[model samples]
Target: MTLYQLHAKQRLPISKQEAWDFLSDPKNLKVITPDHMGFHILSGADRNMYQGQIIQYIVKPFPMVSTKWVTEITHVKDGGYFVDEQRFGPYALWHHKHFIKEIPGGVEMEDIVDYKLPMGFLGDLVHPFMVKKQLQKIFKYREAKLIELFGKMEKEENYLVLRKI
Candidate 1:
């Protein structure tokens, strides 16, 4: 199995609380996600993200085939940060951490996702390039939609953190 990481950071022209509130809401995901992927929240919105919570969704990876993903909220720290992990899905592993911090005039939002593709060695032969392309398209659309929806700041730029220890 091989792991690939993707990190995206954006500075919003709003308070930390505002940023936290938006990201914390599961329903807001559809608004920020790319339309092509067909992302939707299947459950876990009623209680509003407590530990032991599970969020389910059907992601259309291709035209006819759909992957059902069930993610468990492993960690939560009130309004500061949260982590979601894939319990049952196509990927071998998926850990996504969402962090928000209050900066001078706005909030700094960071998303760190470490995921592994399936099929041990054969996975690399077919899925790596396609998966990377799909993710890039999704995240790129998200960045543009965020700026349009949240009203951007000067620091609304994403970065790649090659190493995190």
Candidate 2:
């Protein structure tokens, strides 16, 4: 099977700790995702994101249909980075790493994910090219969603965790 990698980066004006705390909370995902995507936590916040924590989610890419995914946090660093691997989902394998660094200007957030879809050759034939556009759309929505939330909560020393897009 071929491995797929996705890289995304963002610069936020917020403090390191603030960004870390916000991103560290798994429940906070709904807050930063677009409403149209219909993102929701299938499992409660019992496992807020510790090593071996399995979190479940229900996401609707469009309007009616939805997909369920379960992921486990494999590793975590206090304020540096964390990794999540898909335990059960549509993909053959999914390993996602989120890295954060404190910069002079602000905090830099990076996302590095390695994933492989199901159906081996069939997945390659149909998805590799089409999936890129879909992912871009999702991330764009996330970027805008972050801008709105951070903008609303903007204040001194409270950097809102990202640049206003």
TM-score of each: 0.90, 0.83
TM-score of candidate 2 versus the correct structure, residues matched by position = 0.83
Model 2, span 86-164: residue lDDT tens: 8887678888898888877577778877777688788777564555556667766666676565542223232112111
In lDDT terms, which candidate is top?
1
The ten-residue window of minimal lDDT in model 2 covers: 156-165
CA lDDT of 95 in candidate 1? 93
Q: Which pairs of residues clash in candidate 1, taking residues 3 or more apart in a chain or in different chains? A: none
Best by TM-score: 1
State each model's C-alpha RMSD to the native: 2.2, 5.9
Distance from true location, Cα of 117 in model 2, Å: 0.9
Structure candidate 2, residue pairs in collision? 12-162, 14-159
Tens-digit per-residue lDDT, 88-152, candidate 1: 99889889999998888788888899988798778666554677777777777877887898887
For candidate 1, which ten residues in a row score worst on lDDT? 156-165
